[model samples]
Target: MKTKAVRMYGLDDLRLETFDLPEMKEDEILVKVISDSICMSTYKAVKQGKNHKRVPQDVDTNPIIVGHEMAGVIVKVGKKYEGQFLPGQKFSLQPALNYKGSPFSPGYSYPYFGGNATYNIIPPEVMELGCLLVYDGDSYFGASLGEPMSCIIGGYHANYHTVTGKYEHIMGTKAGGDLIIMGGAGPMGLGAVDYALAIDNRPKRVVVADISDDRLKRAARFITPERAKAAGVELIYVNTAAYDDPIAHLMSLTGDKGYDDVFVYAPVKVLVEEGDKLLAKDGCMNFFAGPTDHQFNAPINLYHVHYSNTHIMGSTGGNTDDLKEALYMAANHLINPSVMLTHIGGIDATIDAIMDLPNIPGGKKLIYNHIDMPLTAIEDFGKLGENDPLFKALHERVEKHNGLWNAEAEAYLLKYFDAEA
Candidate 1:
């Protein structure tokens, strides 16, 4: 079989090529990738290449596929897993394979098993570790988003608060407590906001603080304060850049009581320090962003850690259970993962889209593995509609959903741009 995929050759090098795939073993399953959400981690991998822990040192000769957040349909099930999986079944997977204590994952490690491809072979380790998931969602993008959403879910679950006298700590963010997300207007930050509101034990108030007014405004439009109120939670969007003393201004929102939970979405030192100051007694701060610098350091009040029960922690990726929960929530409409998406393109566009992800200035960039379109923002659909009828229709579909991407738009895109058509 032949597959089209973006391969990493070296640092700052990626090439989109079609190559023949070897015969699949009975223990391996072949799948047709439909949609994959480009991630910043992929950008990091490309920048570091073999130097990255997850990327192989022999990538120049044995280049690996460069996507992980993927969703698609099974094309061929191996004989060993005949009864468990079937052809044409929708699928997604937990990419954090933690297989045999190795840091290798699907997107960064495997050559023929990554997401940015028309077809991929599912390794036996994925099946054996129970990381392969059967997606029951209507949209492929939603399944592709499951991996990121799971990371958000894991952050929430990983937060812990301690009791005054007990040795065991309480897991999860404090229920009905004040919460704030610093630099929260970005894609994953928005996902955190969505999950914060949708969860059973909701926070009393959620404040999303960011420097960009445009990003904050867009986030508010998608996850509105009205929607938060209806969900029995208070939601506020603040442009922290506007205030001279941002920390003092944000702290004032909690009535000077401080926030029970603080999530720092950016890797900036100031953001981390500010989040540390805003923590209430027993407050748990989650450093959600991964910094590129290995020597990244920030100063926190150790006095508060000793006397005020303040603590800090971070999570890189979610476990299998988190991915399943994310998929279930999306399927049930408990949360809308589309809130993280802002752009769409084809397999041909992936190389450039990923190479220039930082400068793109939007949310998740979705790549349909079998199409040929350039990377186009959902907001630009209306303008592109002026010249192209496809964009005209896509613009109309998304306009119906408050200028957001949805399944209707996805189905239309697949039909008109079907690679096999």
Candidate 2:
């Protein structure tokens, strides 16, 4: 079958192409991608005209399909895996599919199917390790979220410590502790906020620092007043840019005591230095955003590292532990991942979506691959309106799923919750 996918040709050039699905091998499964979310990695790859470790740049102009965060239903499975997965059942791609004892186990490596396309082929080794979820939950807007949440899991597992070079784990371990989400107005920053609020117990003071007040205001859409009040965490939004000395401002806000945890979700050299300044004595700084291999260059002070006793850590897409936790939380309505999704359009809208990242501020952007399909009735709540045929169809999809979507969507949203709801 021919499926439409967002293919990348070069820098800032992407197109929607209809391509045939690859033949399924004896140890593979075919899936129909329902929804795929725009992730930083995906956005960066298309924007930079090159692929990273997760996305290989096979051919600069070969028009590779770009989408990692996705959820879909299994339509076809090979003879060797008839009972493993059934047709019509929803599923999600773990993305890090690794063969246990094979050369590609864990970090070994392999080229796999990304989520932006209509149908995908997953080999047995990939399926056994990459495929996840058995039941569907919130299918309407789940695929896009799973990938981002997995990155958070990756960050957590990195065991981030303070810049002071402290070997101890200080951040995210106690309550009444402060967290600084630098450049908090963007989608990834919002994801960090959502995850922190959903899980962190420390007196729960979150400082969302960004240059745009409008984006900060928009963060409220995902965090309802009820939810914020219940958490009792003071969510403060600041329009401080990295222009002069943003760290000074953060220290002033915290009375120069520094915060317990700092999530460097967005990359800004000065902001990172400022993070280093505001890290508490036993704090931890998490470099959540995966900056380009060549983009970051700065000097570190050995004195600060030794005296402050801080810890620094970094990670990419998390392992299986993070994905599983995120999915389970999404199933129970702990964190409202859908609220973080700001834009929804078809595959053709991908370019606009990527271009809008720097300006949109908050919320994940989704590529609705199944544009021709009708909407589910109840799923229409967050939609712009019910007039469009697709919106109405989405409303119906929500109703059928009873508040939950397919397994893929549900697993995608799981990363927002800190605790299992």
Candidate 3:
């Protein structure tokens, strides 16, 4: 079958092409991508191309596809796998394949298997590793964002520590302690906030810090303070840029005891430094952002690391177990990663949208591969309504829900929008 996809060929080279996908083997499954969320890692892979660990060094032999956060439907099932998986069922992929104990993953390694394309082949290794997840959720949008959500959940699990002298570990985030989310206005930052608020062993106080007042205000609109209070969590949003002495302000909030867990969303040098400073005794700082440069350097307080028992850690993607947890949480309504969605576009504009993702000031930007449409930010629904009839309909449905993307808006787009170009 012929399908459209964005393939990373070389350094600073990404091209959309119609290519022939191989027939499904008796053990493989075919899926048609419905929804895919653009991730920062995808942009990084495009920029670095072969320099990226997973991307193929030779574009001719192995030009890989360029997206991982995706949800699709099974179109054809192999004869061998008739009982386990069937055709026409919804599914979401756990992109962190870690296949054969190699760093290679789909979207970065496999040419015929990736999220950016209209149709894809689920490789034999993916199913063998249980990287394919069944989606019974109401919206594929939620399922697409589950990949990023799983990373956040994995970070929380990795940040677990025990101050007790015994040779043991305390799993997950420290309960009843203060937690701080630096650069918390971004989409992944918002995911960490959602997970923190919804978890059973949640922190007593969650302080979300970001420089942009507008983004912070937008975040507050989604995860309202009232909702946090209802969960017995005191949520606070702070303009970290405006603060001359942020440590002083946070100290006052925590009654002199600093944060127990601090997650850094941005890979900025100053943000990491500031987040490291906010650690309490036995505090764990999770450096969630993955830097593009191999040797990205940042300063840390060594005294705090030794005397105060503070430590720093980093992680790239989630495991299969984490993806399952994310899907379960989304299905159960514990956390809606879609709350962070700010823009929607067809797969036709995916290359430009991804290249300009860092400059685009919004949360999650969703793309539907089979649709033919331009990039549309949710905030512009009302203004675009004045001229475009399609947007006029979008304005009423999206505006009523405080400018957040909803399942209804997605259904409308699928109904009215044109199919693949």
The top-ranked prediction according to TM-score is: 1
Q: Model 1: per-residue lDDT, tens digit, 1-421?
A: 9999999998999999999988999999999999999999999889888999999889999999999999999999999999999998989999998899999999899999999999999999999999999999888999999999999999999999998998989999999999999999999999999999999889999999999989999999999999999999999999988989988888898999999999999999999999999999999999989998889999999999999999999977888999999999998889999999999999989999988999998899999999999999999999999999999999999999998899899999999976431
User: Could you tell me the C-alpha RMSD of candidate 3 in Å?
Assistant: 1.9
lDDT of each: 0.93, 0.62, 0.86
> lDDT rank, highest first?
1, 3, 2
Q: List the candidate 1 regions with Cα displacement exceeding 4 Å.
A: 419-421
Query: Residues 357-411, candidate 3, lDDT per residue (tens digit)?
Result: 9899888889999887788888898898999988999889887777777767777
lDDT of 2 by residue, 304-400 (tens): 5687767676667767667766665565666546655655555566656665566654456676665532222223443633556534444444445
* Superposed Cα deviation of residue 120, candidate 3 (Å): 0.7
Clashes of 2: 37
Hey, what RMSD does candidate 2 come out at?
6.8
Question: Candidate 3's error at 136, in angstroms?
Answer: 0.8
